[model samples]
Target: MDPKKIFTTILIWLPSVIITLFFIPNALDKILHSSEMNKIVSNNAILIITGIFLLIATALFLYNRTIVIGTILLASYMTLIVFIHMYKGKSYEVAILIVMATIFAAYIRSPFTFQQKRNY
Candidate 1:
């Protein structure tokens, strides 16, 4: 296994699992404090749906068959998080953005990916 892919998968998987634990309450707080999350996914139904997607994405990240999709999902998620922070006029831990960007780069470099058009 590529060391970078291993690192990226670990990075995406951990926080995704952690976020699933607090999705509802955190969404509630976001809705109260910021307008972006509410605007994008206001109702509990959408929140639940996205939350479930996060959970499943993390699980898929654990298996080889579904990892690219998981990386895409997680990358898009973290991008949105960065956007949300900017939209709401706030800044967040730079580490988060850096991690997200690094995972994205690692996924692109992963030898298991057909899109890379190379073999390890």
Candidate 2:
């Protein structure tokens, strides 16, 4: 493997891995301990559902074929989290960072999805 290839592979996958690491535990916690999570949100069902959604999104993200959809779902999730944190007067920096990382990773993984062809 060439050094450039190694570097590009790392750049493309590292962010996604980091984001997955961050979310998987949270998702499991929500699903397994929805009772505790209910203190933050009123509905336990919503927490469990969100956890399942996170798991599905993360799975999609890890697979090359569905990376775009996963990126969109994860970014959307993080955007909602950002808003919730803002409404509560909490720092939303981490959620914002996750959204940026998700998009960056997706772009690197599939540049064609983001490229716009010029008619000229």
Candidate 3:
């Protein structure tokens, strides 16, 4: 394997894997501990739904065909969480980091999707 190919692969996948690892456990926690999550979200149903959404987004992110949509979903979700944390007077750095990671991974995966095409 070419060294350049290996480097590109790591650049593309490392952030994706990190973001996946970060969200999966949080999703499971929300689903399994809705009562605990109620302190943060105020509604158990919404918490579970968010968890399901996260799981779906993560799955989409891992799928090559649906990665763009998944990245959008994950970034939106984390952005919402960031606002919630700010509104509640909590530190939102981690949520912001997650959002950044999600976007970074997606950008690395599909750089062209983010660029406007020009007909010369």
For residue 94, what is the lDDT in candidate 3? 86
Q: Where does the lowest 10-residue lDDT sum fall in candidate 2?
A: 35-44
The lowest-lDDT stretch of 10 consecutive residues in candidate 1 is: 18-27
TM-score of each: 0.53, 0.87, 0.87
lDDT of each: 0.58, 0.88, 0.90
Give model 2 RMSD, 1 decimal.
Answer: 1.9
- Cand. 2 TM to true fold: 0.87
**Residue by residue across 1-120, what tens digits does model 1's lDDT show?**
899999887775565444444443544444344434545556755665666666666555545677677666666776777777777777755536644653554454454574556578
Candidate 2 segments whose C-alpha is farther than 4 A from its true place: 1-7, 38-40, 117-120
lDDT of 2 at 18: 86
Q: Tell me the lDDT of model 3 at 86.
A: 98
lDDT of 2 at 57: 97
Clashing pairs in 1: none
In model 3, what lDDT does residue 34 have? 88
**Model 3 agreement with the true structure over 41-107: per-residue lDDT tens digits:** 5798888998999999999998888988999999998898899899999999988988998998888
Quantify how close model 3 is to the true structure by its C-alpha RMSD in Å: 1.8
What TM-score does prediction 3 earn?
0.87
Pairs in steric clash, model 2: none
